[model samples]
Target: MNKKSMSKGIIKDILIVAIGVLAIWIGLQVAFGTQNPFYVVASGSMIPVLQVYDVLIVQGHEPFEDIKVGDVIVFNRPSGQDRVIVHRVASIINDDPKIIRTQGDANPASIPGTDFPITKEEYIGKVAYVIPQIGYVTQILKPPMNYIIIVIVVGIMIVKQISKKKNDKGLNINDLFTKNNSEQTENHFSELDTLEKDKEYSTHVESKPLDEDNSKNNSDKEQK
Candidate 1:
């Protein structure tokens, strides 16, 4: 209820959420047998089949020897850019040492070094699943936007906390006001009842003296 306790509770909740997220990430990694079990499609190279920002769930457990033509795969670029690429297998150059070629679905032909000479070492995994457009969320979390999002979230939390504190204070004030009104009402009724009792007692006392004087006059008349 106090400021310090509220702050501590918020911090504890944040830690719990963070830990839960980390645990899920680790579980996915172990289940998929890959350090990076997920990858976001950054380019339209695999368009129509794999759009830009499509989320890919890669399974590293797939045997490299099982790869064949037309199968979509994720691999490190053989040459330039030194980045991951998602493309379909154009051909299997060799089976002995496991060499292959890949080409983007949108491209006319496979680029020489960029797509060819894919060895097992460069192979990451097969595309196990595709989640449409979800990678855009990851993209949005990328630099300046992530910072902006954090600020917005923190601001909302602070506003909610302040609002809740104000509501609690308001409720307490209302209870006190109601108690005072109730006490005042009860005291007013008690005073009215006391006044009524006093009025009745005074009327009885005044009527008694008149009755006694009347009795004495009547007795004298009778005697005369």
Candidate 2:
């Protein structure tokens, strides 16, 4: 393909891949009933059960009223700076208006505001699944590293396409040369055949006249 068409094809493929990824993200959100269905654990507070950089799949479909003790949950920090926390439910502080207490497994005790008085407003979702250490990929893909990786991948793709085009052009030139050589060889053999046929015809014509002269001399000698 020409340069313009090849570039267009590559762009089209990239767009299709981007759209497919977006569709999958939307589908996951709709299916799990939460905008933030996935979260990566940033701390080792829940160690033994969960580690740093563990990937968590949270499910929002679990009713708030159904949250029980011993269940792990994701929630916004109750007090201080706004941050997401993943902890195990320690106790049900209240039933109505749903208040709960949470504590990290590694911590000796739960901090007052950080762990207790968790209202429904702070609730995000229940920890539905855990994938170990997969969040490290996201960590590495942050900021400058991600940009570098993208540039490297795009550069490699472009180089490969250019090399392939050059190879195709080379093959076409070699095929043209092969075709010309074949035609020249066939014409040379044809000319040689025509020359041989003409030579044979000339020899036959000269022998006929010589034979007629010899026959006339033999008839004169027989008459004498």
Candidate 3:
């Protein structure tokens, strides 16, 4: 491929993968019913159980009723505050709004200014899995860096797939060249056959006798 076409292809591939990342991220949000399905623990609030820079994979979009006391949960630090906090549910304060009392593992008491019963709407998800200290790397890959890394990953995935297909099919550049040569040979023979037919038609048309009736009459007159 020419340089221009190759560059276009690379750009197209990167865009496609970037769009895929966005789609998958949206899908995860819908599936988990929370925008913070995977959260990075930014604070030392959850201390011993969860440290700063630890990545937590919030499991399930479980209903509020299923949220139980003693379950380590992730919720908005303040209701609808857009801030997340990972704290252990200390008690079920109310069922009407499904309010729960939560306290950080390291803190002696519940955070001040946070209302008595936290609602289910404030809960993002429960901490089902944790990847310790990876949140630092995850945080670093937040914006522009993440996009670059995703594009690189997409390129690598494409390369791997191509290599795998090549291995599975046992195909090489020689095979491609051989196939092209065979096709060229077939086309050449086809052209030769067409030319031979045209030549035969030309010979047939040229060999036809002109004024056949006159020649026949001359022969008869000569014979008489």
lDDT of each: 0.66, 0.66, 0.59
Clash totals, every prediction: 0, 0, 0
Evaluation by lDDT, superior candidate among 1 and 3? 1
lDDT of 1 by residue, 40-116 (tens): 77776665556676667777998899988867889988876478888889899998998999877655446666678
After the best TM-score superposition of candidate 1, give how far the Cα of residue 77 lies from its true spot, in angstroms.
0.6
List candidate 1 segments past 4 Å from native.
Answer: 142-224
Candidate 2 residues 1-224, lDDT tens each? Answer: 99999999999998876665566556557756788767778875665567677767677988878999878899888886378888889999998888999977655446566677898888888886565566676667886544333333423433453477543332221232346577854564345423322222233333343366755865675699
Candidate 2: where are CA atoms >4 Å away?
A: 143-224
Superior candidate under TM-score, 2 versus 3: 2
| TM-score, cand. 1 vs. native | 0.62
Residue 36 in candidate 3, Cα distance off native in Å: 3.1
Model 3, residue 54: C-alpha shift (Å) = 1.4
lDDT of 3 at 117: 54
Candidate 2: C-alpha RMSD after superposition: 41.5
Check candidate 2 and list the clashing pairs. none
- As for candidate 3, its clashing pairs are none
lDDT of 3 by residue, 119-211 (tens): 866777777555556556655667776644543443343345456764332122123225647886456434442332223223322344236
Better of 1 and 3 by TM-score: 1
